[model samples]
Target: MKLQTLALFCAVSLLLFSGCGGISPKPSDETKIDKTLPIVKLTQNGVVEDMNSIAFEWNAITDERVKGIYVYKQRNNLEGSELRHYKTLENRFTTHFLDNDVIPNTSYTYSFKTFSKNAESQMSEMKIVSSLPVLQSVVWIKSIENMPRAAKIIWRPHANQKVKSYIIERKTLEEESWKRIATIDGRLNAEYIDTGLKDDYVYKYRVKVVTFDNITSTPSEIVQVVTKPLPNPVKHIVATTDLPRKIEINWEKSEAKDFARYHLYRSTSSNGSYELIAKLYNPTFTDIVEEDAKEYFYRVSVVEKNGLESIHNKISIQGITLMKPQTPSLLEAKLVNNKIEINWKNKDSRVVKYSVVKKSKTGWFDAKEEEFVDIKGLKFTDPEIGPNTTYYYKVYAIDAYGIKSKPSIEVQVKTPAGVRDNSKKEEITQDKPSRPVNKEVEVIVPTQDFN
Candidate 1:
């Protein structure tokens, strides 16, 4: 029981001395000073300063008992601030120290102490120093705004010889934060081209220089630029609807100085996807469909020399090929006096001529058909037909443009049987009893109409 109680008491004492959870407290400033030990002395002219760094040098110590030295620093801007342990030089003969963690245009107070195994000398007389002012950025910057879908930035290279590279930053007008866009490697490279940018958009840019020691200077002046817009669309487009087997499209020529060509698009319907059919410098185009009564839609756009195209026009023009002539109407068909006759009426005012198509059945499985073209009259008589044979006939009209219409309704007719030859033979009579008299027969057949 006594051993356990002792162990508990030791554990509580350890926690109390180590400030709970086995963590040590922060070290306090040194109060005990050994006046007999030698203190560090600073050189008369051993301080060098720059915008981002400070270097200090001191007289070397020859004391064998001195093991190392401790350096402490305090910011001058903070009120009632104590010196904080910054670094330690483990060798007694070390005479130089560099502080690069300090910022520009800031003052700091520093002190040093010489220490042995168990004792430290008094703090040396404090030294106050300041870093130089911040470095300036490049002077001249220019931006080219008229490039298509891109922007070019140019500037005079930084005059400082310590510069290593340049950092380019950009921001749009709607954004409040600047974004790092590029890092140029060479100090003498004075041009940067930013591509794949939005057209007709405004952007802001600035340049920052990095030194050889990796110190970034202040940003240069901001420059604003706008990318070039797209080319203008073609205007006053017209399409012909009355031409046969072809469509003619015409538009006003582009007036832009950078115009390169025109794009022609075609589609079957107004809402269908338009396909690019042609690219040319001429303002007129001919589309030959080689079919009658066909319709199509079209759109045109202009392209610039940089291959930037204008927006597609929402309105499309409709074009159509010429239609064929109206069909002819059959009026009458009849077989009269060993002949077949067909009559038709022209329904279209554009019809200039007519044609008759005749079909005759010559045998049980064989038939013959013929078309009589360029007939000036509406009625046709076919005398070349065989007797007692059925004949079919149809009529069609033709226009001045050589376009034929649909055939008329079919008409059929059968010719009557031809007259049979019959003559009686007279018995031979002697002397002057009788002379052979010839008998003449005439048969009249009425007209047979098959409508």
Candidate 2:
């Protein structure tokens, strides 16, 4: 309590009792009332404070009757049972309640019942008071200061909790796991700095406070963003065989703004000795898997366009998903007069685009992977292979995440020497193309908006 409060209390007490002189009011056994109930009044029915304390004041009862008054409190104003039935009031006109212990933004109900030997004033209408406690507002500052390798975090103090303690909580975006960052005791001095990160990039942060009865306040707004201006995701990347020779990897971008390009790292093993593979423009990268028929790992690092790596942390390898890219199935390879027509039913929607790689002395090489973009939903016809050469064919599927899958079960296609030399061409020509149904073709197509 402030010093002025004690002085004020003494002065008020002196003034109230001074009017009573040396004689104390006598309590009568009989009730004094013209009606069935004694008259009771209030000087103030409600109060608003800084969640510190309230001086409840009411009109003193008269009629030369009334032995005592009982005060009550209710946390829920709907009110039947008072949280506390009672504290005996020492005065008729006023009682003081310490509100600093109450939660901010909560409503409380208080009332008094005065009694005499034969009658009790009907409980004075409950007074509802609300306080705007010194609750805080959390402000996110410089982000996770130490990033990735050493997740460091920094933020400004809550504006309202100058008289309370503060604590921080964190979790990885990849899992439902959450843990305490730290606790600061003694009416926090304002700012909090967090460190010790396990992932290459740090992603989540929140703040909270504790109050009377150890009741913790609701957490502050969630402020999530990359801790450093570096490529954060440097782990959990996978090599795909779909675009053969080239592997695809992808990860989520930071929730915060102010970032540009991710750094892609390639390692022969999951544990590092990594080399900067590529400076990615997006959360994805496509590169030669490096070694064929061998497994490897990759990760992305969050890098600011300004060239700052967030505290040496990168998105951990654990951040990567292991789901292999799917390979389209039921492939049909046919010869058509020096040209090879490849078709398949897309059982896998991940087939963002299909690549036809041909095996040569140099190893399996893309026949038309670079020429196609977003050709995921299609069939391909290639005449680029030299005639009379039998070529082993493989189909690869890509996904929105850039993770590539293993090359579909390898198949074979051979181009005939000439139009007559292609037996499959002759067989195909014998069958006519299917025509559209009449009713289905008659449907109208609208190219413009209804408006």
Candidate 3:
């Protein structure tokens, strides 16, 4: 009976040992793998490369147990794109990745997860990203003047971070190759002015952008601009003041299709202020100024149809008005000692000379010889007339400009029949006269002082 109790105790002890071996020990919290994803920092924002390529970057993960990284992307409905897994990275130290397969005008969402030795962490925060749209063509290019010789080029700016500078290029219709005109920073000016250009020319322009990574963008749309032909200036302006109180201005017309009208300017002095006096379609203008014996200035300019005015060509002239010398009167003719003598009353002291003309009784008026005397004397003697012959005499006065005055009343006289030519008489003639005769003499001769 003692041997049986021992066997049962042994069997109970063995069963207890077996049940203890079947039970498992609980694990400690220190050995458990984390299920949360690593918090990431954006190292670089989403940026465009080339035209359609994109690149993104982030901070490295800090978890000691992180074995690999998984990058996931989704197409955002806001961007009109589809959702899909973009990439899975086996390297946990990788901080950046490139997305070459990107469409323009489409948006994307990115998320990353960390995988430990036992478990996968939760996905990190989703990152919204997109590439910039392609560079578009220019909208329009034009000139500001009606007769254009310069152009202004304009374009829209790109909104991407990679864009650094803009390049402007041009090609004229006469040239075969393209030429770069300007390069501007995208952060500053957006428009360009091309001046000193030829008129009536056709030009084409284009633009491009450069990124920080030294990548060039596609060229913008081409714009074609045609310039208008410039009009020529008015030529040969002349001013004349020949009338009593009027000034006449004349200029050659500009033979241009864009010729609209003309403008006339007047000034008292050559270098003084000028005022607009008249607007005319014709090239000739007559100004009725009341002032006399004064100098006047004038200018003329042509206006184009586009409102551009040509350069002014100016002219100046002086006008004068002087009184004429008075006529002489009281003409008388008489016969003395077979010679004829003629006299006239000198009423005008300004008269420089006097003229005497005589004709036979039945002779035509054209067959008469005229004699002249200076201010020295008012009387003349003729000895070549035959005695008892009928003759007629007249007198006139002359001015400085060789203008003649009215004639005096005609007188008739008769000479004695015994008279001969003056050359035959010895007493009335001298070999050499005291002063030059029958010519213009400007000497101050001795005269009887009436005072």
Candidate 4:
């Protein structure tokens, strides 16, 4: 009797372990044909409300031997279709099952069975069901082109209230794959502005709806846009080479509707770095330099009101200040008969007049004094000379436009000591002879050029 009790206890323990804590063995094809087990019948047809989920209802099980229900599904439309175990309802009281793994727009065959510790029932009558199609994207989309460094996309809000957000995607014309740029929250948000984009580039965009379940809808119609290009370069640029101590630049006024100003750049060489010199609304500019005959390279660009600047003109223009008159050449400077005489030759035909600059020392400790004398002739004579004093002289040529040439090489001369001026009359006394008295006088002329 004790042995019988031990065997019964072992059998009950095996049943309890197999029914509760153990993984149920999948029914083989031979076992699936067995009809000894009770079958679970569907109470109603399967229902599908969305693309990815389906709802199923079945009659409650009344058999005391039944442990659970097994759900099997098959894609009927696919080749080599076969029934596969999909899910298991461990509780006998579960009359409803939600199948969320079904594909959108696909037909599936479903079967149900009741399973116990030792056997599974024959498969129930197969039900043909399909999930609804994927949610459609927004119907209308528009793109605003020609925006500065940005693109704007606008679309009509999704008609379905289930949509919770929008997914924005973009691609350039040169790209093959699309990129998700932004996710805008709220069904009513209908516009997105994509910034920091390339200028003058073409881009494609599409919109998708995201439901509250996080399932993405199909992409909307593709829309193309082009960012605004830079303004056109300034045309007909010209630079003056004959202006005195200045260079004048001129160009044709921009005809673009967005024209804001002109930017002028200057460089010392054609290929060197250019520095912005001026920004002006007018098309003309003047650059004043410190020296004449100065040359510079120039380029011009047009600026738009949006702060976009056109490319620099590929070919740089050359400009120059007016050339100075030729320097005068000093011919002679000597002290003759108590006076300093200076002479020079004009080498430039543009020279209309000349100037003589005389530099002399006032005293041993005093600063040097300079005197300028203007003359129409080539020679100049200084009559206000001091005896035994040294003098330096330079000659300059002046043009009709008041442009002065560089000073000539300097010359030096020294007057004789105790020299009497011939221009003064001497009074003769009884002690002095009326005859003219002549004394030897030494005149000093520069042997080398001062400068």
* Candidate 2 C-alpha lDDT tens digits along 90-185: 455443434445656667777766765566666677777776644553555445444434444455655553436767678778859667878877
lDDT of 4 by residue, 1-451 (tens): 9999999999999999878866655655565444766687877564544688888888788887777888999988799999889888887788898888878888888899888767788889888887888899999999999998999999999999889999999999789999999999999999999999888999999999999977789999999999999888878889999888899999889987798988899999999999998999999999998787899999999889998889995968999998888887666665554556676666588888877777775458643655454477777766566766677777888888677888888777766667555332432111121232354534444454333
Model 3 lDDT tens row, 196-265: 6677688788877877755566777777767666567677777774454577878887787778899888
Q: How are the candidates ranked when ordered by TM-score, highest leading? A: 4, 1, 3, 2
Instruction: Tell me how far the alpha carbon of residue 167 in candidate 1 is from the true structure, in angstroms, after superposition.
Output: 2.0
lDDT of all predictions, in order shown? 0.80, 0.55, 0.64, 0.80
Q: Please list the residue runs of candidate 1 whose C-alpha ends up more than 4 Å from where it truly belongs after superposition.
A: 1-31, 78-81, 132-134, 416-451
Ranking by lDDT: 4, 1, 3, 2
- Compare candidates 2 and 4 on lDDT and give the better one: 4
Model 3 residue 134 lDDT score: 61
Steric clash pairs (candidate 3): 137-221, 387-416, 388-415
lDDT per residue (tens digit) for residues 42-143 in model 1: 899878889888998999999998878888899898789788878878789999999999888899899888887667888888999999877777899999
lDDT: worst 10-residue window of model 1: 421-430
C-alpha TM-score for every candidate: 0.80, 0.37, 0.37, 0.83
Candidate 2 TM-score versus the reference: 0.37
Top model number, TM-score: 4
